[model samples]
Target: MKVTLDIDPGHTQDEIIIRCAELNDDLLKIVALANSSQKKVVGSLGKQTFLLEPGDVYYFECVDDKVFIYTKSKIYDCALRLYEIEEKFQGTNFLRANKSTIINLAKVRSLNPILNGKIEVELENGEKQIISRQYAPALKEKLGLGR
Candidate 1:
């Protein structure tokens, strides 16, 4: 695949041209990443009350029927649900590690396999989360490892 970026000074906008002889998983991943970055999240608290930044978030979790964004400093309630947040952050280094958790791969420091088909994920901040076996395959795939 070949990617070409065309700049038009008069138009004040840039154009992207992707020339590929065949489409594969890599191409799909690139497209997904580009689309995910365009998604915006609106906080439930208030428009100006909380702004969610991808880098600042360690993970998104649904607990007690409420969605929360976990950051290094604090956690904020999100207007969107777990599934919604998962879709919005897809291809952005965030993966659904469990039923109620969407973890940032960039924030994961290490993974350890535990008993009964569960894996423990240790984040850079020393926080640990359990990744159910059902979602373990997906997490392994995202990490570029085979299950």
Candidate 2:
């Protein structure tokens, strides 16, 4: 891959043009990073509201009737439903890990097949999430590991 930095004084905002014949996994990752939005999720703790970048989230989990956002060190309350959050961030790495959780594939460190056709997902922060048998195929396909 050849990277060129052209300095054009006329342009206001920087633009990127990727010249590739085929979109492969590596290239796709680059595209994701380049096209990443400045989007934030509003999380509230007590009475204070915090703006969190979607990339900072390890996963989103719903317990009882409320949804929570899990980051590296802290968890915050989120107003959106589990499915709504997933649908809003549609082309990104977030995927449904189970019926109640959506995990960021970028935060995953490794995937290991576990018992009963399930997968034990190890996140970058040393947290574990399970990919249910029903959702295992989608995870595999997303990671380009499907048959």
Candidate 3:
């Protein structure tokens, strides 16, 4: 793989251009990652609202009826629904681990195949979550691991 960076003094915002003869899985992943929005997300802790970057979020989980975003040490209430969050972060690092949880693949440290065709995933923060049998294939595929 070859990488080249061109600096344009007149350009206001930075831009990336990829020149490839054919798009492969790795190239597609690069495009997905590069195309992910840099827009900040709003989450509230108690009564105070906070702006969060996507990379800082470890995962998003729904409990009962409320959705929360988890970082390494903090959890904040999110205004979006599970599916809405899922749709917004599509093609990025987020993956649906189960019906109620979306995980950030960037924060995953390890994966262990458990019984019942499930997968036990450990995040960078040492928190663990299980990938349901139905969703395991998608997670595996996203990670470039065979289902």
Candidate 4:
């Protein structure tokens, strides 16, 4: 696939045009990535509020009834519940690892099998999370990795 960009000084809106001879899984994935509607969410750390892009999130965790979104360097509290966050990023890069945590597959650096039928995933930032046995198969399927 070829990608081209046009620099229009007077352009008011951004647009993407795909010129392809045939559509395949790669093209479909390109479209899915380009057409991301859930671009950002609201999060707060202590007293400072900020907009968080899903691509920047390493994972989401629910602790003591509060939901926290983790990035590479910071953790922010979000107003949405775990279930809500799970539903929002369902078809995207986020996948549920357990009852209390949702992980971003894009941030994963390595995955290793554990003795308890679970998987130990190491994120790009060096943090690790355990994928429960119940969620292991689905995560492997998503990544096209054998169980």
For model 4, how does the per-residue alpha-carbon lDDT over 1-147 read when each residue is reduced to its tens digit? 577899898999888788888878677766766654546867998899999888999999999999999998989999999898877776677899999999999999999999889999999999999999999998988888775
Evaluate model 1: give its TM-score. Answer: 0.82
Model 2 bad stretches (over 4 Å) = 7-10, 18-31
Error of 1 at 121 (Å): 1.2
Query: lDDT: which is higher, 1 or 3?
Result: 3
Q: Please tell me which predicted candidate would have the highest TM-score against the true structure.
A: 3
Tens-place lDDT per residue, model 1, 1-147, is 455555566876544455688878888778766775666555544445565667778988899999888888777788788988887776778888888899888899999999987889999999999989898888888888877
Poorest 10 consecutive residues by lDDT, candidate 3: 32-41
TM-score ranking from best candidate downward: 3, 4, 1, 2
lDDT of each: 0.80, 0.89, 0.90, 0.87
TM-score of each: 0.82, 0.81, 0.91, 0.84
Model 3's alpha-carbon lDDT is 0.90
lDDT score, candidate 1, position 107: 96
Q: Pick the candidate with the highest lDDT.
A: 3
Using TM-score as the yardstick, the better of models 1 and 3 is 3
Model 3 residue 86 lDDT? 87
Q: 1 or 2: which has the higher lDDT? A: 2
Q: Of the pair 2 and 4, which is ahead by TM-score?
A: 4
Q: Write the per-residue lDDT of candidate 2 for residues 1-147, one digit (tens) a residue.
A: 989998999889888888998888788777766655556888999999999998999999999989999999999999999988987776578889999999999999999998999999999999999999998998988888954
**Residue 80 C-alpha lDDT in model 2:** 96
